[model samples]
Target: MGSLTRLIVFLSIFAAITLKSNSEYLLPITKHEPTNQFYTTFNIGSSTKSPVNLLLDLGTNLTWLNCRKLKSLSSLRLVTCQSSTCKSIPGNGCEGKSCLYKQQNPLGQNPVVTGRVVQDRASISTTDGGKFLSQVSVPRFTFSCAGEKTLEGLPPPVAGVLALSPGSSSFTKQVTSAFNVIPKFSLCLPSSGTGRFYIAGIHYFIPPFNDSSSSIPMTLTPIRGTDSGDYLILVQSIYVGGTPLKLNPDLLNGGAKLSTVVHYVLQTDIYNALAQSFTLKAKAMGISKVPSVAPFKHCFDARTVEKNLTGPNVPVIEIGLPGRIGELKWGFYGANTVVKVKETVMCLAFIDGGKKPENLMVIGTHQLQDHMLEFDFSGTVLAFSESLLLHNTSCSTWTSQK
Candidate 1:
């Protein structure tokens, strides 16, 4: 009886340790309204916890921070030029003995910034699949230390950029290596208030989303690899209110890239087609059009548009992608389709990226808000929940829960 009791206790202790080690990490995402950018904050220090707010960039390779604001530098360690860590980092250089890393500012304000590849203790909250469990310390967290000048165009409080791209020195890669967990991260961008960023493990949400029988379905599409490490996915066709727009096949040959930096940018021709189709549909619904906004061509009088719990009652935009069985369509409802730039004005949230742009279409952060996007690097797939608002919940709903 004594031996059996000891075995049970030992198993229990082992299970606890395993659970803690494999637990997912959570970061709260805050939307900077003026810039339409999203950022996540975490602590980086050994003796003390100093909060660092970083812009979430899906295309950036290396995570670079303004070390000038870092309070505790006692635990900081610089990578040597000869070390394997330095060799693993792309665009690495040697500045004396310390390894140098060159990172681009996602905002395009500072094209290139050189920094030292460094490691330090960073802390983040871990969850027990659904709720917050405890805070865990990640030792030797890899990141680069950039100068103050590199923070141009970033939010006043933001000190750095968190790279979520598929790079050797990306935040996702380092976290996966440190925790020995799956190489996946889920981003829930909120239209307002706060959202949640889950790293590794299963993604859990509240009532409707968590319910197995009645939960909203997710569309899984392939994530095409790019030389620049940007997340690109093939968008076969686009429809505005169930009517497909006539687009040149060549226009979509390059595929559409997901960006957290700018607003949705479509090739001039594609934009015109989408705008015209949407305008016709809006007119049919008795929606009045207003003068075009700077970036958005389709602005409408907010008073004329009806409002629902989801958002402004506007035409749904569907992005069609290749699915295993057939074509999968990710629908964007009013909440994700239109943005209120003013009290009386709302606009179709898309920008015209002139002719010959790098990627034919770039889906931006404004359209991504209130949607759940899971980037699974191991599977090379992107599983997306079209719009959380459709399920009578927003990304903010997830963060508000305990």
Candidate 2:
């Protein structure tokens, strides 16, 4: 049998050996207090375990946790430079007798988080309500330990991060490798209801999403280069009210060049183009007195827009992918797209991604509030479907024109 088949057979036996009687486990995720950052609680260590809140990041790879005052620090098994796991992880080297790992931000915009690599016993709630599932113990898992110092951009109280990227050091790769299962997972974040993060075998699916008829299918474009880790999708053209904007041809190419990175920040050039096109069309349709808001160049009068959140006269923004795959549309009524910044001022949430060559276009997470995105690593595809729950308070109560 092939290696993948052999591994699957091995996991079937291991599951019985471990007495973990379940085909899947769900990690309940919640929004960070006062912020949109998504986080989940993890209980790590051995005898004296402690719970820590970690940010769920798709852009990052390695999972790092604060180990400054971890009560079970003594129980961690430090990986040496000679180990195979150390070699698999990039930027790993021997410091005296310790195996140290480093992930430096190519851009100086963010601080570098670095530390030694070690394995420990960790636990996580496997239910939607954060109920502890005794069978799911992450034994002998490798991760980074961020001592007392604070990491750049990481806010207070949020201990560290749980990276869900496809990179070598990512948590998903480690988990699947340890259990000998196919490396695949899915995330479903609703606008108001509970969200679920899943790590399962080849045919990974949440309860309701198992039906094939309930999902919209699309191909995932692999991002080339050693630096590309997050799920990046291809774009054929972008249109504002059916009118195509002149975008760089290289960005829309079929082969593995950079398409947009799916994240929370949008590159300046792309955002500027969309905002300019949308704003110009709005003014021409009888919306009077156009004014610019700092940070967000495209904004309208809050008082006038309050009466009509439908963004009447404003065109629907559509991003088209080749092969008639599908178009991602943004109507004016969604959560963060059109937000009220002040009592009298409301602005578009899209912001400039500063001057950076690699600051390529990114699809903000807020845009996926009412959408279900599936990242199928085994098939190399990204599937998307509109959420079943349509009546979101932050969004327009009227039926969407999807």
Query: How many residue-pair clashes does candidate 1 contain?
Result: 0
Q: Which pairs of residues collide in model 1?
A: none
lDDT of each: 0.84, 0.58
Candidate 1 Cα outliers beyond 4 Å, as residue runs? 1-22, 210-216, 398-402
TM-score of each: 0.93, 0.77
- Write one digit per residue (lDDT tens) for candidate 1, span 216-309: 5678999976658699989899999999989989887788899888778888999999989988999899999999777678999999999787
Q: Over the stretch 40-97, how does candidate 2's per-residue lDDT look in tens digits?
A: 6667888778777777776666777677646667888898878888887766778777
Window of ten residues with lowest summed lDDT in model 1:
206-215
Q: Measured by TM-score, how close is model 1 to the native structure? A: 0.93
Error of 1 at 21 (Å): 6.5
